[model samples]
Target: MHGKFKGKHAIVTGGARSIGFEIARQFCAAGAMVSIFDYNQEALEIATTTLTNEGYRVNPFLVDVSDQLQVNLAVDRAEEIAPVDVLVNNAGICLVTPFLNIEAEEWQKTLDTNLSGAFYVAQRVCRYMARRGKGVVLNMSSKNGLDGEFGHAHYNSSKAGLILLTKTIALELAHLGIRANAVCPGYIRTAMNTEVDSDEFVEEFEDRYIPGGRVGKVTDIAPIFLFLASDDAEYINGQTFVLDGGQLAGQKPWKWLLEEIKL
Candidate 1:
């Protein structure tokens, strides 16, 4: 609660749960007024009510980030509540399917939600941030964004586009006093990972992958968002912070390599 983000107001897309929710939690803990936006009305209500009861100033907005009209309306509505000082484009979707078997509609949906959604939200939010002459933007990406995955062609491509979009947005908005950066995480343990967190999958994944001997937690990645959104990161922009616990340090798990090298 002692960071440079104190007293700022933020809009966190897809903040109903998972990494988005954790980001909102830390921001509020750091003394920022947070508005959580998500299309999931149930989770939105639950999150907002829970935070409100805890004495944090939180408002929930129900809107689909992928739709331009919805994005604009949500931003306008949020602006009415308070000027947006920071924006976290955390709303995105991921699906695993072979590249050859993926359908055109599914591919379009992946890009629309994962890549274009960030664009739509940023386009609207930055207008106000630009006028104010000082604001921050954080985009949620994945390690697959850097390295292509076998069954996640659509998701991987969208995230790759998002990373570049983040870089370009940073440059375009820098002159206006706005900062943009992307966070690329790997195998975070959130509700989104339930499908992969099963016993068999865990045995398969953590057995050979995740050199740290564990999957990542939402809390582990939350601070990066909090940092990028704060004045402490004023000089940091257009960069992607990877939070995979040495999963991408090299071709081999660096942790295991270190153990062997030490022995």
Candidate 2:
């Protein structure tokens, strides 16, 4: 119950599970009164109960960040606990559909949830931070955002847009004592990804993309996020951190690439 963020308040969208939950848990453990915003009532209940049982302070709100009204009202409610000191913009959804086959509804839903939702949450919470003249915003981007991935045109586009949104937030808000950044994670072992990717697919993905030879764990991501939330990262802003196990490092010619070249 004693750490760098003691007495601070953190708002984590999508905090009901996976990477978001880990971030909220760690923040709560570090003594931040964490407010979790998720659209899922069951998961939210489970997450809040888990933290409260562990002697951590946490509040839960069923918020769909894509809806501005929901975002605004939830922010107001969360502030009743305390002013927002940190915001982890993590609420997002991904549907695996081919680009040519993507529906208008699917495309809109992806952007609305992943990109616009992040915008709504950040805007609402940063206002609270701006008044205090200090706070942090951490947007959850993904490796897919920066690089091309098969079967995720909508998801990829939304995440890519988030990177720029994060940068713009930093540019405008840094002067107000707020810093914004994006975290781009690689093949992390989260339920969201696991549901879409098979066990064999995950192994193959690691063999081809991840140089670390294994998929990343939520543990690999939460610590870096908490770091960005800490005062130690005061000078770091408008930046993107990639935790991809060298997937994007442009490795030397592999079997497929060498065969394609056939020199």
Maximum-lDDT candidate: 2
Q: Which stretches of candidate 2 lie over 4 Å from their true place?
A: 252-263
| TM-score of every model versus the real structure | 0.95, 0.95
Clashing pairs in 2: none
1-263 in candidate 1: lDDT tens per residue? 46556768999999999999999988988888998989999999989988888888998989988899988998999999889999999988888789999999999999999999899999999999999898899999999999888989999999999899999989998999999999999888788878655867865676577777788889999998887877678899999999987878855545656778753
For residue 253, give model 2's deviation from the true position in Å.
Answer: 5.1
lDDT of 1: 0.88
For residue 159, model 1's alpha carbon misses the true position, in angstroms, by: 0.5
